[model samples]
Target: MHTTPHPPTITTVAVPPGSAIASALPGAYFADSYETTDPDPATSALQAWLSTVAQVPGWTNRLMALRNRLVRLAGLKDLGALGGDAAHPLRDAASYRVGDRVGIFRIRHLADDEVVMGQDDRHLDVQVSLTKRQPPEGPPRVALSTVVHVHNTLGRVYMALVVPFHRRIVRTLLARYAAR
Candidate 1:
């Protein structure tokens, strides 16, 4: 008999004390994380799944639209979309290198156990990490973390406005399945 595999469920968890992701961005103004138990190839599976969530949700797009209009008024570049330019430099996560772009983040470090990516703009510097921890005899746990460091008043204001939606977005993205 043939059967389909069950998908993993993501959950919000307290940041592991002194986790690398939290320290990735110095003087970070915001940080959060989510976790799921995955199997072998956890890092790759998580990477594949993250590629699908770059654009975020429709409601988020609407909010981005409003943000674009307002930020433009303040002479900030209109960050066209959440996904960034994945079509050119980064078509997929299957063949990404340490310097490649993954959605809006640039890969700072990559490995079988973890990936560290971030972007530094005039407003802020943000870092993200996806890690897989395999135990001796249990399902592997995958954790995704984000840290943002504000560079100025504008950055602080921008983060303040988006913090609420950011958590929800992260949860929504993680609730889905990782690639098989």
Candidate 2:
């Protein structure tokens, strides 16, 4: 459970303006970014993304299960369990491809510094990106960003109900990854 010498915190930042993700996903009703100091420049975006997801805590998964049950009653998709846990850890997870499933999301794009993945449903289309950057004079940093385009009133209501909890859950997840 060792942490980095740098601040063990993740900062909520603005999503890169006019980024490609934004260009492709215009009219997004919701978008946000979270950043953390990433010391290792060798880490691939897919690795960072998978490792971060693997950090999802048990309570969060439980909450998701409850959410799944409730949402299913509304005819929403049952997303199943969240991610790999200690009991079922993700060791040497590979097969990173464009169409592969990464938890509830699919691999949409993979690059050296960023991997973009998310779910597209009748209600909304979500695109999530995990990017790593190496500034000139400081330790490297990693960022996770999400952009959502809602398709209808159902999407808006669903987003409204989820956005608040979404922020808290994402902060908790990113903080856990930052601690690593």
Candidate 3:
């Protein structure tokens, strides 16, 4: 049997700032940005990830639906995250768990500290980093994001669910599976 990485779901709750849940790990991971110079391994990795997830049966429909949303969100040339209505499926499937670790990836903002000779700019370059975080005894996290230009006016939209909420997502998915 093929095992896939699943992120946790989000519930109604108040969490502290800078904390995991408050940082929107799951959503951010899906819509994260990487450096332009970085290796383009995600194209293959993402395909493999989706393939592995789809093999689980029953959940193929749900997994594909989320993948489409991710494609649309990334196809946009804008420089921001992807946003959607509350009823959007992506919002609901934002959380999942493969095993014990809750899949809540972190989005880190990387700034360039160099200066351009001909261009007058303060921050030369800025990028975002994506990393997975696992809870005490949950599924392993998958960290990843796309690269976008910050100067774009369209910006980006993402479902930001903090790290603390990761457990909530995992708990929900697990309960649903357990009920079955």
Candidate 4:
């Protein structure tokens, strides 16, 4: 009898307490992380994940397309198209200096094991960080986390609408990484 292999697991982790991205916005109204065992260098792994995620197909693409339309109608900046002539969808650490634009986000900080990106609009400021850590056992772990601070009622409402989809996408991306 033939059987299919079980998919790798993806875990939702608490955002690291002292992460640089966590510091970007005190009292972040929303924050969460998804992690997987990935032995590759953090930056490279994250870059690859971003590239792959950007090419999302099927229902995910449909959702994102709807999001793009809604955000545009709301006068919010959409994450511009990624990975055409560029090597990766988001700017790489080697090419991005602080303040450089990467899609809808801006490069806030970069390190060998982590990269922090942020976007600020009238409603809120959002920060995302990808970090790599080596635990005592097993393969290295990579975590993707985001922190958002709402400025007003609109910010709160916007976050409420996006958080669910955000979690789904993050988990899906982590699962993809684990599968690789």
Candidate 5:
């Protein structure tokens, strides 16, 4: 494996319950780290989408809060490398093959916004859509709403799966860390 830029450390900011803007674009953070370079194409698209969110006033804090939660759950240390490999748990989880099912559920939605993927009782739900127009050409675009939910399996629970799936997808599609 080739060594890449160091992953940005996950910053634990003290966001008051109702202080900052929710859904505040991830671009600010990404720009701060990469000087707005957005190495991954998906991230570039995300930055554009966030720009739309930034236009809204009150929604900022709400969106920021949600983004914070999603980022935390993703197990991603850096928003800079949204597509680059940094140790994703969800992708590995979805790719797991045991017996018949791996206790993961996924759903994919095209022509919509938000790529929703999660592990239900025994399936992975993945949804992909296009809410806003994506950047001209960058990484695979995914909605910021994309997420991975975990479920309890019959005494065979792998919680790490949810975390990594979200991380991989975010860094890959939404953030474009994995974009060529």
Candidate 6:
């Protein structure tokens, strides 16, 4: 397990210029990116983050379980069964491609340094991108960014309700990766 002397910092930054996500949609209602130093490839970092997030425990688990149930009750799709043929633990690069579903999002694009996932519903469209950047004098950095465009009043309301928990979860996930 990964450990850190202190919690890793998660800063809000603009989406990097020229990111595929920047051009994926217009007028995003919410967009934020958080980056931390990590030598892992973007895919691996993302997979690790997902593993941590999906296996929620204790109070957080109960909260998420309730949230998932509510989302299902509203007819939003759950992550559907990941078939036996599907990559276990969802870390395989080859398993992701346009139209592939990973949890509630669809893989929109994938590359050596980045992967883009998105979901569109009657109320909103959401896109998430993960990227790894190697610098000349420092450890490689991994960033996760999310952009959302709300389509209606319901979309706005949903975002309002989710943004708080969203911020905490994203920060916690990145912090976990930094510790590793």
Indicate the worst ten consecutive residues by lDDT in candidate 6.
Answer: 80-89
> What is residue 11's positional error in candidate 3, in angstroms?
5.5
Rate residue 34 of model 4 by lDDT.
78
Colliding residue pairs in candidate 4: none
**Model 3 CA deviation exceeding 4 Å by range:** 1-11, 16-18, 21-57, 60-66, 69-174, 177-180
lDDT of 2 by residue, 1-180 (tens): 998565467788877554445565457789999887884568788888777888788888888889889888878887666574333344454666788777777778878787888888788888888788876887888887889999899999999998998888788777777777
Error of 6 at 44 (Å): 5.5
Clashes of each: 0, 0, 30, 0, 42, 0
Residue ranges of candidate 2 with Cα displaced over 4 Å: 1-7, 17-20, 84-93
lDDT digits (tens) for residues 1-180 of candidate 6? 988577666667777667788786478898888887764554553464454445443555455557667778777644432221143345454556678777556778676667688878888889988776776787777777899999888889889998988777667767766766
Error of 6 at 88 (Å): 9.3
| Two-way lDDT contest, 1 vs 2, winner | 2
For model 6, how many clashes?
0
Order the candidates by lDDT, highest first — what do you get?
2, 4, 6, 1, 5, 3
**lDDT agreement with native, every candidate:** 0.68, 0.77, 0.28, 0.70, 0.29, 0.68
Model 5 stretches astray by more than 4 angstroms: 1-130, 133-142, 154-156, 177-180
Clashes of 5: 42
What digit string (tens of lDDT, one per residue) describes model 1 on residues 1-180?
999866567777755444556566456688888887654453463364465355366886677678779988988766555555435334656677778766556778776667778778789888877777765786777677888888899999989888898787776655543433
Angstrom error of the Cα, residue 84, model 6: value is 13
On TM-score, the candidate that comes out on top is 2
Error at 134, model 2, angstroms? 1.2
Each prediction's RMSD to truth: 4.1, 3.6, 15.4, 3.1, 15.8, 4.2
Task: Residues 1-180, candidate 4: write the lDDT tens digits.
Answer: 999977767788888667677676568788888788774654453464455455544566567668768888979866544222242245444666678766556768776667687888888888888777777888888888898888899899998898888888777766766666
lDDT of 3 by residue, 73-179 (tens): 65632221122123321222223222211111222322121111111112112222222334366443333223223223223222232233323333333333222
TM-score of 1: 0.74
Runs with alpha carbons beyond 4 Å of true place in candidate 4: 1-3, 42-55, 81-93
